[model samples]
Target: MVYEIGDNANSALKVVDRVTETLRGDQWQPTVSVNEAREKVRIFVKQTDGLVDGLVVMVVGEADKHHGDTGNEAVFVNIVGEIDPAELGRITKKLNIDVDV
Candidate 1:
């Protein structure tokens, strides 16, 4: 049977969900901050394979109250633990984001 556009989209979503579930296990979920004007989700990702220490990622809303005018920065953060600043900077650069701890 030929799949319609909607079917393809749904299949893609399912695939995405599966990938997310698989990858998310290694990454910690963000904690919500209620007091802040905009809710911020902070997650700490522990390093694996004897790499450097974990890093923190903050997911904030796109609302102006969250200090995000473009609302494109769904994830923001800086490196934490035993890691090099330069390395973190490189990663942030690759991600097209400015890391803030």
Candidate 2:
């Protein structure tokens, strides 16, 4: 399960940042962080030994959180490929997120 981050594209990207902010050290290599649209963003991460070679993570948020949203939560997170669970857990813990795989 994922967390209800926020509404709108910016919020979705912020979630990505929150998850990646601590992805430092020689073991991690972030290739790019790009905004595909006003309401979407994608981030690619590559482990030194090439653990993840595809879309590391991407997020898409609703344009209008209040249009038909009652709870106003519209952030969507998509993670592709795989990473070391222990490393991921350490990162998530610092971000106040839970890791369960």
Report the number of the highest-TM-score candidate. Answer: 2
Off by over 4 Å in 2: 1-11, 48-55, 64-101
Against the true structure, candidate 2 reaches a TM-score of: 0.38
Give candidate 1's whole-model lDDT: 0.45
Q: Give the top-scoring candidate (lDDT).
A: 2
Predicted candidate 1 versus true structure: per-residue lDDT over 10-63, tens digit per residue: 343343345345536767433222224433333445565656576654443334
User: What's the lDDT for all of these models?
Assistant: 0.45, 0.47
What's the CA error at residue 16 for candidate 2, in Å?
1.4
TM-score of each: 0.31, 0.38
Candidate 2 colliding pairs, count: 0
Shift of residue 81 alpha carbon in model 2, Å: 7.1
RMSD values for the candidates in order, in angstroms, are 10.0, 9.3
**lDDT of model 1, residue 13:** 37
